[model samples]
Target: MKAENPKASAEVVWANNNTDDASLRLWREQSRQLLLSEAKARGLQSTSPCLCGSGDRLRDCCLRPLR
Candidate 1:
């Protein structure tokens, strides 16, 4: 899926049909963290395009809401 859409979320791409695999699960978590870090580094404005390149505003797109 990454080849088709490099910005696709790893969780959505790497799902194991609701079953879990240790390596894949760890990889998904790590990928999420990495993306989150990159997003923080961008520190984009609400009007700016999302870092994911989905054409949505940064605040309206992918990253998890920080608690």
Candidate 2:
């Protein structure tokens, strides 16, 4: 399968390699925070377009609340 965001992947790798110990520590913490944010987002209501350019509100469309 093709990568969705090759640029982002490259940037992440560069950031990881160039970061100092303290910066890397902060990056790890931020990554953890992002993971938690995404987990919480899985349940939160979304009434906007999708990442695929589909102009559908998630809660009203594909990612709608479980019935």
Candidate 3:
């Protein structure tokens, strides 16, 4: 799905599934935080294209409602 739509985040892809598993939710949150931390460490700016390959600014894409 991501390959088909670069703009789709993992959350977006899994949104329809709606799992109640605590472990899975924790893992997803941790992974998201890790990715964001790594991006910050790499000096990614809000105006930079997202590493997710969404072709959208980081702030507009994965960084939405965060940074």
Question: Model 1: per-residue lDDT, tens digit, 3-60?
Answer: 3566554545453455567766676678667766776688855567878677987656
lDDT value, residue 67 of candidate 2: 17
lDDT per model vs. reference: 0.61, 0.50, 0.69
Q: What is candidate 2's local distance difference test score?
A: 0.50
| Most lDDT-accurate candidate | 3
lDDT tens per residue, model 2, 32-65: 5554465357753355554334577644543332
Model 1 segments beyond 4 Å from truth?
A: 1-20, 45-49, 57-67
* Decreasing TM-score order of the candidates: 3, 1, 2
- The TM-score that candidate 2 achieves is 0.39
Give candidate 2 regions above 4 Å deviation.
1-8, 11-17, 44-67
Least accurate 10 contiguous residues by lDDT in model 3: 8-17
TM-score of each: 0.47, 0.39, 0.50
lDDT of 3 by residue, 1-67 (tens): 3434666454443444565567556766776787688788999877888987879998788666332
- Model 2 steric clash pairs: none
Top candidate (TM-score): 3
Candidate 1 deviation (Cα RMSD): 5.4
